[model samples]
Target chain A: MPNADGYVRTGRGSPPVRTPTPRSRRRGVASAAALLVTAGTLAACGSDDGGASSLTWYTNPDAGGQAEIASRCTEEAGGAYTISTSVLPRESSQQREQLVRRLAAEDSSIDIISLDPPYIPEFAEAGFLAPVPDDVAERVTQDVVQSAIDGSTWNDQLVAVPFWANTQLLWYKKSVAEAAGLDMEEPVTWEQLVQAAEDQDTQIAAQGIRAEALTVWVNALIESAGGHIIEETADDPADIKLGLESDAASAAAEVMKSVSSVGGPAFTTAGEDANVTDFEEGDASFMVNWPFVWGRALGAVEAGTLDASVPDDYGWAQYPRVLEDEESRPPYGGINLVVGAYSENVEAAYAAAECIASPENQAYYFISNGNPASNSTVYDDPEVIDVFPQAPVILESLENAAPRPLTVYYSEVSGALQRIYHPATAVDPETGPRASELISSVLAGEQLL
Target chain B: MSTTTLPPTKKTEPVSAPRGGLSDRSKAERRLGWRLAGPAFVVMLAVTAYPILQAVYESLFSYRLTDPDNRSFTGLSNYWVILTDSLWWESIAVTVFITVVTVSVELVLGFGLAMVMAKALKSIRPVVRAAILIPYAVITVVSAFAWQFAFDINTGFVNSWFAWLPGVSADTDWFGDKWLSLLVICLAEIWKTTPFISLLLLAGLAQVPDVLQEAAQVDGATWWQRLWRVTIPNMKAAIMVALLFRSLDAFRVFDSIFIMTGGANGTESVSFLAYRQTIARLEIGLGSAVSVLLFIAVVLIAVGFIKGFKVDLSQARGE
Candidate 1:
């Protein structure tokens, strides 16, 4: 993963020393020497003085989907400019760190960025992103999902163009639900899902790691109960108000405690990937996860790693509610296209970003990468619906999904929330108020955590 | 790169210079020494000193990487905040716990291995030496991942093997509990680094005179006494060096904790906390404060170790 500073971040996020493959290990000495020379070269050419026509897009690491999009957009450039992608670190926080550091330095090599939705506010607040051109903004925002548009906006201004949107659906095993006598067509509550899992002696796979994933889960629950983690937010950090002391928060905490009581043994350490691994083993009866699981299960079946009938039993519904009467607000996540303020060819980069986020491209990305599209029109595409039979459910979830707290201090808020609510079974009514105080104090810069 | 090019030609010529009047020869030697060290000094300052000074300067401000324009001079408030935070102290406590446990265990285990290599069957010395170095050769991250997988309930065998033991569940999630996660982190640390300690101790063992052991034995000294009195005292410098290096390395432990538990379950070391604060949270001001504290802590540890052992670092640096 090439960070904006041209440093390779390895071993997840802890340190730079990663496990090298045998080939790299054999060439370690040569690579070390090469790295020193490359570092010097990168320092000398910190801007786009060499080739103005070539644009560099710093994309979050994905499984070849963004790379393909870059190639497609390059073709669509039609000799205007060639776009190349540099993969950022795997972790979102690391990617943000690298970009923030480089952009702070006004490194002009950063022409485009695939930014995480929660970070757009921080980047925009710092003036790292170029103001969206009116023409491009109108075209990009015309047919996109409302939640995606909301996520791309910071302080009522659209700082980024929506590319793709993601929201979790309640995936279940048909046989397990049947065994528990749970209806498939009706909206489910977290209480009912937990009881059903308990009745059938199965697990509900969900991310519970003490990271951003935990914050995502907590925010979704709270939002579904008609409460926002931050009931009111402002550009000024001191003006933020956390809604954690409300009854809705209590309801959310109760649901979490109940669900976690019956979660799998590795619930505390389980990330999305770990949850999916257990789900694929047919041990989990239900899971709340992003759309990628749909493609993953099919691929597993096609590879004969999973039972052929598992796909037949696969089903999905809207995100679970915290209360029986309230509608669920699933977690919203996605990539947004942001033009760098320091880009030499800002117009061309914006044009390429538009090309990359067009409806046709969004539909293609959805079909290929299993990431739901931000463009609502893409959901109605015949190929998208054909590939994902539950496309409507994902689209509906995206429509109602609530994003994590939108603030320039989102990192501090989310980090504190994760620390307080982790080990999900331990969350209680008091957790809400405690987390609120901690988040408030931290964001106000009166406390350190 | 230029430093690498300049030092190779005249490296041996300085030592062979003819004797002269004391003042003239000393002046010439000093000039030559400064010329030889000048490039290295500049490069070192550029790489290490600049960043540290920048960190110190940033720590005095209210700086956020994401909010560049919001920076303001805070004048030591960041340091004051960190010093008062319970989380900072907890991280320090955890780091010290890991450092002490892992280094002590490694010392005992490494000493045993080194003894075997030094005094065991001569015919198997080559095999023993190679075996002892295997863990040292494996990458830290790879070993950490291996240990993580081994302790994971879903993918590992450790839980299954311990299932039959009392109070051990077959589905135990080692990472779910704080102490257990620390245990696993220490296990990975000890597994990866014991070999390095052993290799260093093995060098010390080679310097222990066999004739002294024979004389002690002929004088009716028991094996245990000879080992405690003669062999240990003879290798005291080596032991002090090994302890200082290992302890310092262990105090900065980040890779295993990050890979195995990700500083979750209260297992975060000070370095892990710094990384989270700086890279993950983007609180450059607060993070730099933490970094400066960590640097001071490391320096204190090195000085404490060196002073405690009376190890001459000037000699260690081959002055």
Candidate 2:
């Protein structure tokens, strides 16, 4: 039973005392004086030097993984610029919040930015995105995914381009496909994948082995089945056009439930670690993730910590097309960069973005981090093909992937669905009613965005 | 000098003293005292009062941080939306629940620790106190990570040990379970904050005279009886201070829940909800409305507490 004084004092980096004596008094004065001195020094350090070529870039893309790519750009640009970068700690929603705060503060030091998708619209709407010159926007439009442009578009203005694009693609292990006695070359229907997953489970189990078929998947079920998580208008939420009421939507949920009931459980909360953890741990033989996981997971599998053959010995396919008659459409899941509409140095920022969008720099990003190009033509590049063999197959998914609805109330609308149809609504009993009610409310403008 | 001496004898002249009474000081001295402390006062005003005022001002308009230009006056509209929303009300309930549960648990745990420490032998007291403080000593992020790892599905130690417990499965995912995840967050908070409360109580306990306890024991009063009548009444003032501080801190908790559950699993606290709306959804006007509401709530609480306890706080502190 010691005094809690020590603990409290430690937070302040001092010991508890009744009051300051002459000796302690001196220490306090000296510290204050030192702080003032430090402040003065910092002020002097912040004075304009006028000609520094250090470019500060904000990104959370592989964080440290973007360095070599940046260095190469600086080198190719003849060292007129030295790239410095900071990684945003949060992704998507959280990142947008952090960025807004920074921009509102109007910091002069932020020379460059890397915005995530979904953020592009807000920034673009707020006019925070810097407008790229016609020439630059033209070059960018050619190389990046069309979906990537959505974040950068506002009133027909091009504000940013894709550093790398992320489109969710289907990844199935070769052994698992063979075990299920399914043909990889054949197009997979949602029903076919479900059937194959179970059959594969049985074949593997016949040898006293175990594997989960019908592990969790997104895009395929959500958008393909015509579920609309985002609404374009701020109206009565009750009229939301979420595809929950559609036949495909119900079918996807019911099919997912059936697959789970037959011993093919969805991915548990082992923390998908961006899907790699799910696949590499053998909990799933396939998953939907952006391209980067491929590069990092490659080492683990090769080292035998993971099933090495899972990488090369696999099949990549675009998300299955929904039944033609169904209303759901594929929604693209990827990253996009937009100009900070509030930036004073719009031209400089645009120039930097152009540098990143340059074919060589884009290739550098692809080589270092395995980021896929948004540029449609880059899929056909020999160098790109050699680096990412799955690129060609994944490209098809991008073309079909739909943009999440663009609306200010997108968060509220999406949140409603997330709440109603949690666990993919695939197996949850109350989800059908909940999702139906939520979607109805959204459509009616009585629910949310 | 001779005339003044004569006059002083006649009037029995007052002698000068080292320290003067209030009347002896000039207006300049009083003004100087206020001046010496002025910078700090102004700083506090800027840092605190300004933000509060800003929140109020923002609440009066449709303030969007992203769309700075569109922050036009839309008086009371945001407030109207929040008050009418059932989801907003649910957040209010969740925020209250977290605050009540966390503060109550911390108070009890902290008191128990304080009691143990207060009675320990001088030589061993420091060690025991330090041991009790180990939880609070860890940084919040590290502590959060520790709890998160303990509950991690694949590598978490809780899963590893769960099979040893009766009737529980090894593979149950703790993070996905709503109430369970919230409980984990609460536990993390209690573990971190208990020491702070205990220390405050311990300081209060030290001021209770030992003579009263001895007299009670001589009168054949049991320990519980002595504590209730003699110790606790003596500790009341300290307890109030600790309670107010703890209550305020707990009411706005956001970090642990955010880290552990990502505010998912149906545990959206008011602060987290505000964050999601303002930052995540770019609903700045709504966020400002929440901030203004929170400010008013705190003010009302303070006023209520003061009215309920008619005794002057300064006088109690002095005693």
Candidate 3:
């Protein structure tokens, strides 16, 4: 029998060995040609003419502040480099996922990245970031708040340029504070806030949701109690030590439990935005939130969604204390700039990053975008003060704030902490030891989170 | 048609011919079949088998996406770690609970919907079907978000609307407790996917011969009796198929739980756990192990449905 391809079967129940026919050979050639065409098309799609002067900055989603800075810095470069902004996802975890995946693949198109502080250590440890030159580092770090500087450093090296810094403040209703007889001039403890909320027949709004916000609140509480979430860091994941099973951790847990009791009925589901809404309209009188709450309130008032008297009664203070004698270490957050290691225009990227993080640009970004500047000088800017009446308190909070635990295994540690200490009302004295074990085991690869 | 060109097998050589071996003409047909299906087979392998095989290969190592260079062979320790952990078991229990509840409830509700659609007046059948399918057509994530917003304490109307009910108030947090969160997630899943089950069951309902039901009616059988004796027995294959697909889908639930609670308050499914390990934590090895386990679980569920129900797909297709 002859097949369609002109191969002949010599006999039954036996495989035939024959020379390839012209038609069969033509089919092979056709397939090979098709393969070549596909390969060529894909290769063409992969390459781009993004020249040495073109830089792509991967930025976390903001209200056009980063894009404005990119354009300003591009003009200042004067043909050295033209910076273009690529907006990443809104969530920090998603941004890290995007940049990390690209950097892992050695994608040179990622010239500059706006990285969250918590993930900076991971990127630096993985050698995904280019080393910050001493001159650039010195210029960017000068006059920057210590917390931002600390957040940007890994292994004692300044791995990222501090762009903007963020910290939580104790936002309280002035009427509630006065009615409870709590001194608005002094720093209050979590104990005091819980007491005042109970006395005023109101609620305390804190982020107890089992997400990164929960991790931030937990870290701030522990740090304010004079302990680090990660007591010691090591190259080996197994050797790292956690500070959860300590007196400070117990105190932090105690404060969390007390505050959660006074937390509104939806406390466990409340994130920063939810807390802001609660503070605006609900029974929540005291909230620990980012500086955006003030901006949000004023914007709501201006938009006619909120009464103007609400903004007049808004009061801002430093983050609540965990202990009477110790100063509160508010949660530090914000974006920092890093140059991708694979970027061909490394020098240009660094220049662009430094230009973007300059005090003047930082002040502009602060005033325009409502993001706090990392440079202390920006807090003293008249426009900044005029825009953010809480500028001084924000600066103070940023100075004393503590970044989340710096570890290459940050996700694992934070995941464990969030899991074990969530729904603040469920947190107990045993939570500290349990979280320590979970973090240690997860880091050591002996357990799953 | 081409078999006419093939040489005939000899009847005298029956002893030499292997019992299961194909004759010349059938062998030729199979060769042609392979030639025709070769591209599809290779494409399926490339798109599906390659990644699953890759996952299995990577599951043997201690790999992190960020620190790829430090990956080392660890055999099956990742699986061992997961199997031993309480968290994995808790997530598994949650997944099973969701699967059982959602599939069972959907089976009943979907049957009701299928009956309505199947027996509706012909003029209104399309409208009824389309309206029923609107939830199914909406993206799962969008539906999940809508459901979350509807139940959210701060922004949701559920609290206020149900304020007069027991344990309901202006401050009721639907996502605050483990069971409550799972309840909301299940509600979202059921609302979004019941239409799919009903559609499948409707097709099954069509396959039940009308004459049999008419005969049962003429024999003075009640509607309930006729349904159990004729309708259900005839549509067994369709029901089995619907159950299989829905159970497998519900077992792998990720989007609703992810959007609603972010796996918080102990609502994490196995798929969500895998996502967290892979994307969030970057634990490639552990995540792959979880994925491989989930794949096995899905296969087992499919096999169980097929075997337990004795479903003949050919019969389901009305062959």
Best by the DockQ measure: 1
- Candidate 1 matches the true fold with a TM-score of 0.90
Query: Which ranges in model 1 have alpha carbons more than 4 Å from their true place?
Result: A1-52, B1-31, B119-127, B165-168, B314-319
Error of 1 at A287 (Å): 1.2
Between candidates 1 and 2, name the one with more favorable lDDT: 1
What are the C-alpha RMSDs, in order, of all predicted structures? Answer: 7.1, 9.2, 10.9
Q: What are the per-residue Cα lDDT tens digits for candidate 2 across A128-212? A: 5566678877877875666667645655666667666666666677778788776667556556666776665521110000001
Estimate TM-scores for all models.
0.90, 0.83, 0.90
Give the per-residue lDDT of model 3 (tens digit) for A1-449.
Answer: 00011111122222333587999999989999999999999978655545537899998777788888999999988888899999886668778887888888999888999999999999998899999999999999999999999999999999999999999999999998999999989989999989889888899999999889999999999999999999999999989988999999999999999999998888888888888888999579999999888777777788898999998999999999999999999999988999999998899999999999999999988887788999999988899999999999999999899999898988888889888998789899999999998888888888887
Clashing pairs in 3: none
DockQ of each: 0.33, 0.19, 0.31
Query: What TM-score does each prediction get for chain A alone?
Result: 0.90, 0.78, 0.89
Clashes of 1: 0
**Better-scoring candidate (TM-score), 2 or 3:** 3
State the fnat of candidate 2 relative to the true structure. Answer: 0.25
**Per-residue C-alpha lDDT of model 1 across residues A52-114, encoded as one tens digit per residue:** 478999988766778998899888878787889998877787788889889989999899999
Q: Give the lDDT of residue A196 in candidate 1.
A: 94
How do the candidates rank by DockQ, highest first? 1, 3, 2
- Give lDDT tens digits, candidate 2, residues B1-319: 0100011124433355234544345466778889999999999999999988877777777655656775678788777777877777777777788778988998888899999999999999989998887777677766777787787665577866777776345656666666777788888989999998998889878867788778778988888888888887777767877777777777777878767766655677777776765676566667778877876766665666567754245533634
Measured with C-alpha atoms, the lDDT of residue A57 in candidate 3 is: 95
